[model samples]
Target: MLNIKNLQVGLEEEDKQILKGVDLNIGEGEVHAIMGPNGSGKSTMSYVLAGKGGYEVTGGTATLNEVDLLEMEPEERAAAGLFLAFQYPVEIPGVGNMTFLRTAVNAQRKARGEDDLSAGEFLKVVRAKAKALKIDADMLKRPVNVGFSGGEKKRNEILQMAMLEPKMCVLDETDSGLDVDAMKLVAEGVNALRDGKRSFLVITHYQRLLDHIKPDVVHIMADGKIIKSGGPELALEVENNGYADLLAEVA
Candidate 1:
């Protein structure tokens, strides 16, 4: 479970605030879709939740279950079962995908006092998930996201999510730049992980992805605040009527 209250965030060295009094709560097994136009601070919320540096919490609090999330470091947050799938996954020129995943997996396991997987076991586990997601073995052996297509990058993120199996996932624009097939692959990966012990906060601009994921709740954010909350039907309404009426209502 995750809870945020009157949360305000801004650049650490600047006075400009990107998030203003944003509040949200997501519980286990629930898939919540956050739909908003560009510059609505949706991505900002994801970064802040993930404890990215340079984002200062000017007001309020965020917690995972009973733990104060804002007090932890980014790696600590990841170890605490929080995962953020970025809008644009960065490429690491020298880090092979398998190498990167092994390091991350082992680090989290170490933090939790769990035994790290042997290379053989890790390969077996991840290979199965990668096969399900249509990720070739060659991709896993190559540098992380380096020279990968947009679809490959998105699928790779899902692969990591599956391998990590976090309690909560924040998918920040995972649908962006994805082809229809890629979108379905990513959505399937997400749906396969959905269960009573997990939750997802899907931040996206369009409703197409929602068609596959079928979120339990839909939230419309504007001007750094969540101004409207609705069900799956609201996503269709936004697609038809656009955010103009919603913006007016929020105003």
Candidate 2:
């Protein structure tokens, strides 16, 4: 459902090229994992696709279901069914979690020309989704990610993903700060959202997370571009023998 061809990006301020030429195609219901060393442009690809600022798309095209994603604003992209779970979820000190979620949901609905959910209806849905993610009522009532544990913040991100129900989910280093049990909880939450029509682009550095998510394809990225593509075993190879051999082969 997502296709990118010869995509190129550079920092707007520095004019430093990040994505040399990234080509990827993710089919419906497919889960793809991107594994790369630091500075490999994995997160850059996600940020650009999500329409975040500060990056210039210097070349190529990216489309979702044949829709030109590069032309849409960030909010428009979200409304068009692109969701990004950040590596570090920011804290909004004054905005209550539930309130923020409801506003965001309604805003996206409005953008799509759908009616907003009633207060009661929204409460019920948020509660159910939060419960599934093991987020308690107290947590939901607190400010978004404010004073939350690292794992809790990550879980909150997953909760947002569940509520938004985006067609293409981009998880950038979602496993960064969790312990084994917490990681399993987050992974279970992600697995629950997988269906025959939704696609996931899981960006992680290690194979441990892959042990839970089980991607259909694994890509090794280096020097701003994807150098190799393989099955789940590729992640295993990276886990067992760092990126040295892979990088050497590409070099």
Candidate 3:
């Protein structure tokens, strides 16, 4: 569903490259995870794919279902069915969560030429989705991510994902700062969206999250490129040993 070829990205201002010759293909209905150490460009790839600014595409192409994602605006990418859940979800203190979600959902729908959900419809759907993520009414009534614990913020992001129902999802370290129970809840929310058609690219630093999510393919990225890829066992290997052996082999 997502195809990235020789993806090369560099900072827009500086003379430095973050992603160099990264290529990956994720078929529809598949879950793929990228595990790497800090500064390995895992998060950078996520931002680039989402059409975030400050990163210039020096080379390569990224497409969603064959649509050129690199050429589209961030909102256009979203309307085209691309969703990014940030590692640190920003808190919009003044805006209500309902307002933020409905506005976003409406914007996406409007961009897609679909009718926006009515207040009643949105309330019904969001309440259902929020409940599934274990989000309480009080939490939803508050400003987005404002005063929420780390787990709450992450869960709020998942709720956003569940509402949007994008074709491709890129989660940047959804496991970060989450406790065991919080992680499980977030995973459940993510797993609920895996319907054999929607695809996921999960970027993380550790393998424990894979235990719940169970990626179909696990990729090891180092120094801005994928060094090795294997099945779930690859993650197990990294967990048991480390990236040391793999990096040495590649060296």
Candidate 4:
């Protein structure tokens, strides 16, 4: 579960605020979607939770299962079971995908005082997870996200998520640059990870993605704050009416 209260963030390099007061709670096993127009601080919130730099927390707090997220390093956050899938997954030109994954997995395990997976164990598990995502062996041998299409990159991200088995997941515009089929594939990978104990916060602009991954609750964020929340029908309403009506009502 995740709890954020009046979370405020501003650009580290400038004098501008991104998240004014984002207060939201996601219970265990619940899927929540955040839909908002551009520059509404949707992605900013994700970055802040992931502990990415260049964003200073000006106010409020965020916690994961009662642990203060704002106080931890990015790697510490990951070790604490927080996974973030970026809209645009960056390429590590020379790092092999498998190498990156194994290292990360082992690092997290070490951080948690768990034993590292042997090479065989890691290979077995990763191959199984990769096959489900349709990630080929050649792709895994290549550098992370290097030469991969948009869908491939997103699928790789899901594979990372599946491998990590994080407690809370924040997907920032995972639907971006993905076609319908790619979206479904990615969504399927995400859905497979849902086990009634993991929480998800999906940030997106379109309803097509939501159609694939149904959210238990849908929130509308504007002006850096979550302005409205409802059942899955809220996404349908946004699709039908757009955020104009919601923004107007909130104003």
What is the lDDT of every predicted structure here?
0.94, 0.96, 0.95, 0.96
- Model 4 spans > 4 angstroms off: none
Model 1 Cα lDDT, one tens digit per residue, 147-251: 999999999999999998899999999999998988999999999998778999999989999999989999999988999998999899999999999999777
Cα lDDT tens digits for candidate 2, 1-251 = 99999999999999699999999999999999999999999999999999989999999999999999999999999999999999999999999999999999999999999999999999999899899889999999999999999999999999999989999999999999899999999999999999979999999998999999999999999989999999999999999999999999988
- 92-144, model 4: which lDDT tens digit per residue? 99999999999999999999999999999999999999999999999999999
For all candidates, what are the clash counts? Answer: 0, 0, 0, 0
The per-residue C-alpha lDDT of model 1 at residue 100 equals 98
CA RMSD for every model?
0.8, 0.8, 0.7, 0.5
Record all residue pairs in model 4 with backbone atoms less than 3 Å apart, i.e. clashing.
none
lDDT of 3: 0.95
Query: Which candidate model has the greater lDDT, 2 or 3?
Result: 2
lDDT of 3 by residue, 1-251 (tens): 99999999999999999999999999999999999888999999999999889999999999999999999999999999999999999988899999999999999999988999999999999999999998999998999899999999999999999999999999999999999999999999999999999999999888999999989999999999999999999999999889899999999
lDDT of 2 at 48: 98
